[model samples]
Target: MDDAIQTEPVRQKKQKTAAGGSKAGTAERRGTDVTRVSEVSLSSKRAATAPIAVLLAAAVLLAGCWDSREVNELAVVMAAAIDQADEQNIELSVQVYNPRTAGGGGQVGQMSGGSGGGAGAFVVRSAVGSTMADAMSKLQEKLPRQIFWGHGEVFVIGEAVASKGLREHMDFLLRSPEIRDKADVFIVKGKAKPLLTLPVPLEGNTAQTMGKLADIHLGVQVSIINLTRMLAGSARGAILPLVQLSQSEEKAGDSGKIPFMTGAGVLKNDKLIGYIDVATMRGAMWVRDEIELATVTVTPTRTERGDVTVRLVRSRTKLVPRIEDGKWAITVESEAQGDILQNTTNVDFGNPLLAGRLEQDFNDQIERRMTGAIEKLQKMNADVLGFSQAFHRRYPKEWNKVKDRWDEQFPHVQATAVVKVKIERHGLSSSGAVRPNDEVQAE
Candidate 1:
């Protein structure tokens, strides 16, 4: 305001001088105008300097404040295993990556049994406490650096820990900010520590190897976030991939042990109720629309011994729930398409009639598997497929009345499974190449 107010009079005097005074006086007034304008410019520049300096200082002070732990300062947790120590305490084992040589694509090496034993990678440490968090703190007490879970790929629950309740011990994972959402959840057949300590030939770390298995769609992939979501959803139950330590083909040494994903563990209300075979687990996976790449072998008839394997290319399943006459029922309809990878039967599937029969047989096989899976789950009083969710979505009002008694009602709930399989393509040959040409049946 002062600069403008003072400059206005200068402009008026300059105009007056231009009209009456000599050229010398006009030039002097113009010089005074330039000086005033320069003063205003300098004043504004000086005023902006303070705020700019303050902002710089603030940024500098806040440089390393938010989640600024260096890699060297952290023990990058590759995996975690939980087991029951005693009646009151729990054992927590973590595979902390040795940051000294963890970087680069090379496999990390560690001494599992002893220094002179087989070469193993990663350090497996254990701690026992009353709770998961307590056990974690105990484990951290022996570490030189803070444990970072951002790199953790999987968490394996021992048979004992799973038999107990997982809901009570899941608080740390649910509440921690550093825990990754995609960390896979697994249930080991025996102790989880042995599985983690095993040296896998293909992948150095067994937990990381399990992550790749899930990614490749070899087994059901249930992440930490997904597990909680499924349990909280209408399902009220969950399933986790089951891992076990298998003997290596070479020898039975400390380094010759490998971890293999065998089956799935069933959980009802956060407690492991039972286990399912891999074959049966596939059926459940189909009902849950979780099977991505699987080969289903079904015989065309009971009398035939030849196997007809179909590679599941794609599949979709829909569970529709309804209430009729106060009776709850769910109908599962699934459609799948596959290519015949191996057909050893005498019948040529290229023919329409044989193809139709094959389709019907495949459909029956799928439905049978689904029926068996549903029966097993129903027997266990577990709704792992979220059938209750369907009912809740379809009949929200009626669902509220029976949700409390879902376990009792689920066992008696009427369910029908319908599956349709289409043989999209037969391999390169129209007939089974293995069969002799003289014994071939055209149609």
Candidate 2:
């Protein structure tokens, strides 16, 4: 039995050795297979990325700023002026933003507020050519840097240029992709170039100052798009804010002469026909529903001593077109709310009867202004107030019949003004300070 046990242990040892040899061979085969798979994967990855790498390199080499323009190499036009040079030629003046003036700070900043005509923040460059496009091309040739129109904000037309016609300049402005349609347009009493050269003591440049003035709505405000719509409308009548150099007491040259809105230029058939004074322009604004701020002073019929002034808090106007028995007429319906600003009259606002009378007086004053403006418009035969559009909206068929003869028919169409005013607020004190109880008229 001892011999048998020793022989069995020897056999088991042999079997264990064979099993270890088989396991070692199997592990060796598995390692070889894994190495081969890894080599194939690495080779495939390199092959796949080689073409992409080459394309990227080629793209980098081909990409160069051939068509790009540097900011320093461009002349930025802020404002443009068109003037009648002669019968055969036209002049184009551009206000170029000087790059040198930028970051120099006080030199350009002081330019706006300075009382003398010093080296300005902008440079005015002019060129003459037969047409606007030609003038622009020539102007570009005159400057070393490329002319850029992206920042052009104000367009000023000289009185002579406007009187001649706006079609040529307007067409060029509208077609150019760089020109903004919302740029404010103006008509200067003299040369537009002079207006651009004038030093304004309020804003960065004269263009910005002009833009702010237009925004304040002191007078008639007409943008390129506004003018386009008006001209394209059935009325074909347009108005532009008229600018003139202020006649200051101090003759500090162009620097002292501030550009102020004098009135409005009336355009008919794209030609400037006439102008309306500031008061008349205010009346026109009422008819056109463009009144933003206004102060009205009227003498109450009951009191002949002094005049009462009111500041308009809110005002709205609606043109009601009436067609009856083949006759055309328009009713100017206006509603306004105002606060008593000054009361020179000896009256107590607490009295409803007296307030009613004052309200009536306000209505009468507004009516007179509206009727007077309408009469002037009729006399000029220019329908800048959009009367034609009103009639067309209400009576399309009748308007079409008389649309061609609108200029002739406009004068005959009677316009009636109906104004309604409400004295919403009378000052903190109801009675005047100067007038005592004896003079205070109470109902």
Candidate 3:
């Protein structure tokens, strides 16, 4: 009985081991049965599609252009000038680039040299009409190629044209599909035709040179879109950079060229009412918060006869408007960090008390600039500073009530300015660039 029991247990153990072996063997067999598809097998399928792909490519290549236009057929326009011709007529002058020379980019792109006597980089064509479109149509009649407006880089309006009104002229530009809104706008102190005719000495094209000037941030960077938005909104007025032709020698018919960004042209009701000179334009730029680069020269007191020029690094302006007793007033706060670029006065910057005094002088200088801009705006009743826009955004209800007589009300609005300056570095040295041991004053 004991032997039979022992044998039954041995049989069960052998059966268990056999079942485990069967599972592992079945798995090995399944793995071995699997096979990979060969890459070469795709060759036949590729061969089947080869002719179809070739046929499709041939069909595409054989197709002709639906609208084929030649570059040579277009007259590339670089700049445009508008001026008054007669009481009933307006003059339009276009600077057409001579594409035959200098890779055909300019009579504007192909400048002879630094000298004046040449075909020049562009040729100006003038036409007279009652309207901008009429003038363009008449202008187009004279040219063999169509006026390609896409290449226009600058629009210069004469004092006469600007004085009359920019509304009509701006309408043409805004409605035209061919013209780009990226073009910079400028106001000439005098007639714009002569400015376009003058040969450029520095660049391949004068338009490109003016474009660089507009980007310099010394003056307003007003594009068509910028002006359009300002005019459409409740902004009091818009400002544009004023450009004047400056002769190197001031000789008659000399044409030795230089284009000067003279000042800011103040606009009221889409017409130029007056101009703010470069000195005051700095103040305007301060209020506009557009001072990318500026140098402030401050003379502290009678004892400090010389000027200390602070070259601003990073500057910011904040304008706050408040309604007090149904009256609106703006408080302008400006802050700037700068390094002493020039110190003709022997003010010891190392002395904390002296540095503090110098900083106060800077503050006063900036405050004067802000108030100066505000004063001019008030005098002209032109709100180029957009003070009304601030009031509109903050106090919408008040702006709507005064929107009709905003121009008259704009002149009376009260403004206060506060300026803070920090002179972080005194350039390479701690004191004035020209300093004497005896000339140095005590703190």
Candidate 4:
């Protein structure tokens, strides 16, 4: 019985050991399977996450639609015209661009296409309201696309609008971010819209043609920035190139019928006071130091008989203001270089002595003409010459005393002008086929 009991205990120990080994093996195998399953799940998760990451990145890129504007969605303004519709209403006219004509040529694959229509590149739209902004907004409602002023090249203000005071109306132009300050500004004699309606010749648009003409032949091409500067200055007066429709029927032939710059409109405190002809504008140019190209015809009292047209190559003017004995005097000194363009009378062309005599005659003529203009401005009491500013710079104390009464005192002020001109370069072949009467006698 004792032997049987010991054998039973040994058997029980064996059974316990076998069960423990089986349980350990099963747990180890289960752990391996769990790890394999986790690995497979992780790989699947990574595959799914890759596409989500790409999609999220694309979403971030696609989110920025804040300021996006398609080319066709904008109504590009090429020029603007401002006029006074009535006592309390302001008229705004815009020349809007057509994108069909503005787009690049050709089809999807090719790079070429038919040229756009030239005349319809610009479309006119106008509105009337109490203020400039109001007028613009009213016009905007009629436009199918958003108005864009970035490309605007011209701004024309009518005489009625300018004469009434443009400072208030022009505030929008100064304040707008899209409106370029470099755009050229002109003052039209009649309604501003009429100037824009004129047919353009070689150029695509009337605004561009006017801009080119203003730079080349007009009095002075005053940009929006220039106009602002002049208006903001202490002088509080300015001048703008005036454009008038040409009356010549022949001008309507090859070159499309269009208006040309005829004179300058004088503005006092942002209001059009009057117009100055081309001759007077030359004098104003001297005061402003802006003479680019000019021709002077002077009849020299000589051993000769006709007049000579001297074409000026370069010209400059200096202003000197003096205050003494409770009175003001301004001295204008101008110097110029010219060439004899037309010789109506035969004179010694090669002689240096004759050239000196011609130079003296040209100088006298310029002085007389410039002096007359200075006298006229002095009588008009226009400080367009900036004499008041010069006085302020040189004699500050005197300026402080008389600055208030400058307008009243300017008309009576005395002005002296001295002009000196030099004739450089007689054209090639000094003595042409035409001989002088004296030279003929000698022959």
Candidate 5:
């Protein structure tokens, strides 16, 4: 009985110890639960505030371009022109797309002259002031809606305005945030306003036609950005496509008048110095490595054959500049591969020997063209052929010495053209389609 009594007390003591451990574990679990709840609450608070912070930041960023106007309140500009109004004033002309005339679908005439039969699809408007900005402000006063320049794709400069200088005009164009840098720029013959007023049968207006032509590389394509870089680069010489109205019976006031790009205008220091004809422009393009593809016609010298034309499939040009004893010289190394477009000669192009002769003739023709271009550029003392760029890239130290006097030294710099042509294809026939009487042979 004594032993049982003692063991019972011991067992009671052990149960008390076990009960204390269970209470301690419960307290630790409750503490853990509280910590988890506090962490979740903190995270939920952060998540709730995140969207507000994002919204605030978005509003701040959107404020930059938030000055938006409805389309109906905008007079969309399709093209623009700058001209010398007089010795003291300048003129700014804009062609605005008329939504009323462009909205309806119908016949060709109806499509051009929409529901109300309004004044075609576009209208030309002009304002005169002492500067481009002033003229633009005055132009805004005349328009019913706010002028929108975001859609403009073409800018034409008149001969008189270009000759005067473009620094002041360019300043405004470059400063305007609404203007696009990729817009095509052109130098038009005579008055720029008249060109804008000319009736165009296709593409809504003359501006569309001009932009399409530039995109196709019809002439020397120079965008606003390109002209800016050329003006600012080591060679302050820029080339722009020259616009000329087509000579046809259709008068300027007629509804079917057309304007086309014929040549390139050369500018030195942002001032128009001279104009390059189509042939010389091609040569300039070759020297500048801008020839995409060209169709060249030449009369074969080996035999008394007729004219043969070739369409260059691919071409590459490299300008090699060398300074020998301070004598600066640049060699134009060009290579071309082409297919015979028209073979009016009696000889078969399949013969390697005859093909060789044709190749030589083609090379000679290209060389002559490039030489003529170089001569003309030298005469003008304009470095629009990338000669300045080439020399500067090759010999930076030397370029710095003559850069100031480049105008005086450019006319004397020696330039030569070396061309190689490979006749890759002779078309389906090796001879002319119309066999000559002398080539007649009995079957």
Candidate 6:
């Protein structure tokens, strides 16, 4: 009877253990199935939402047209002129483009009607106010379209205005987002309007023609960027290419009745001090290392007769400042490579020996001309050559000590010039085709 009871309990315990194992396995399987279904549902939801997100992005982009600007609605200004009207007011003149005339066909006759009764291709609008912003606003009221400055070519400041002080006037140009700092800056000898009114020749506009003339005819091309750099440099003085209304009959009968570059205007701390002619301006170019295309006529020595015009193909200048015995001296070294463009007399230009002599003679002449210019500038007490800046660069400590007295030290400063010229070619005409003093026969 005891054995039967013990066997019965063991059988009951085995059955309970089997039932618990099956229940635990079922529960684990159900948990894994639930996790897989949740992952599938999340993926389906993301797939459903993607298209709506893309559509919303497209809607935002289509709604915001904040930066849209039409070209026709903007009245493009090709050039601007600023002048002083009075002690309390400033005058602003803008050369606005006439698209009607500009967009006309290439044939000159087709654009004739849009020339505004022979007033030329552009319209000049002037306004006077207390500040540049105010002056520009006043001018805007007269225009039917908004003023656009992206295509501006030149900025002119009248002598009167420049004399007063350009530091304040220039701030508007420098800070404005529309006006380009690359536009050429000029100091007009008189009123700036006369320059804008002058007839344009090949370029169809006065500013374009003048800008080209500044690049080709004259060497002094002072852009707004150049002016800013000059102002920032230790050399506070700046020189701007000067343009004036040429009333000469000779000029009027010439190409397109366009006015010419007169000279260079000297500026002392942003104020017009005086004017220097083309010759002196060339000297300034040598000191400033700005010579691009220069033709030097050198009178030959006893070894060669007649004149040889050396056309400078490439030129460079270096200013070396040194202090000795508590005195400052600047050495101006100019190295130039050129070719004989015109040779009046037969001098063996092909021969290296003869070329050397010609080169020396050319160098001497350049040195003399450059030296004379430096002397003139020194006498005027002008630091247009940036000698003071050189001093500052070489001896910063010493320059600071003498910064206030640079004007006093400049007049007495000694300048030495060294010029080296190399003649590379003699052009297509290797020898003089026509004999000296021989008249050419008409073909």
Q: How accurate is candidate 5 locally (lDDT)?
A: 0.85
Q: On residues 1-443, what C-alpha lDDT tens digit does candidate 5 reach at each position? A: 99999999999989998999899999999999999999999999999999999999999998777676899999899889998989999989898877776676422222222112244567677889999999999998888899999999999999999999998888888889999988999998788876677656666578788888888775788888889999988779889899887744654444556778788999999999989899999889988888886899999886665888999989999999999997989899999999999977777778787888889999999999999999998898888888888988999999999998888878888998999999998878877777874782211
TM-scores for all predictions: 0.83, 0.81, 0.80, 0.77, 0.84, 0.81
Per-residue lDDT tens digits for candidate 4, residues 224-319, read 888887877766767888887665455654234576777788887888888877777777777667888788887766745767777888888888
Instruction: Rate residue 369 of model 1 by lDDT.
Output: 87
Error of 5 at 102 (Å): 2.3
Q: Give the RMSD in angstroms, all C-alphas superposed, for model 4.
A: 13.1
TM-score of 5: 0.84
- Stretches of candidate 5 exceeding 4 Å from the true structure: 1-37, 44-65, 105-118, 249-253, 434-443
Which stretches in model 4 have alpha-carbon errors above 4 Å? 1-68, 101-119, 248-256, 436-443
Off by over 4 Å in 6: 1-59, 62-65, 105-120, 247-256, 428-430, 435-443
Residue-level lDDT for 9 in candidate 3: 88
Best by lDDT: 2
Clashing pairs in 2: 112-201
lDDT of 3 by residue, 1-443 (tens): 99999999899999988988999899877766542233455777899999999999989987977665577898788888899998878999887777565554335433433212246456678889999999999999878888899989898889888888888888999899989898999988878877677666567556877888888887888898888776666754778899887776754453576677889898877888888898788888898898998988888773456788889999899889999997779999888999998887776777788888899989987898889889987988888787888888899988899889887788888999998999999877656666787888757
Q: For residue 64, what is the lDDT in candidate 4?
A: 89
Off by over 4 Å in 2: 1-70, 109-118
Candidate 6 local lDDT, 165-187, one digit each (tens): 88877788889999898899988
Ranking under TM-score, best-scoring first? Answer: 5, 1, 6, 2, 3, 4
Error of 4 at 365 (Å): 2.3
- Candidate 2, residues 302-420: lDDT per residue as tens digits? 88688889999899999999999988899999999999998888889789988988999999999989998899888998999878989999999899999998988999998999999
Question: After best superposition, candidate 1 residue 225: deviation in angstroms?
Answer: 1.3
Over the full model, what C-alpha lDDT does candidate 3 score relative to the true structure?
A: 0.81
lDDT of 1: 0.82
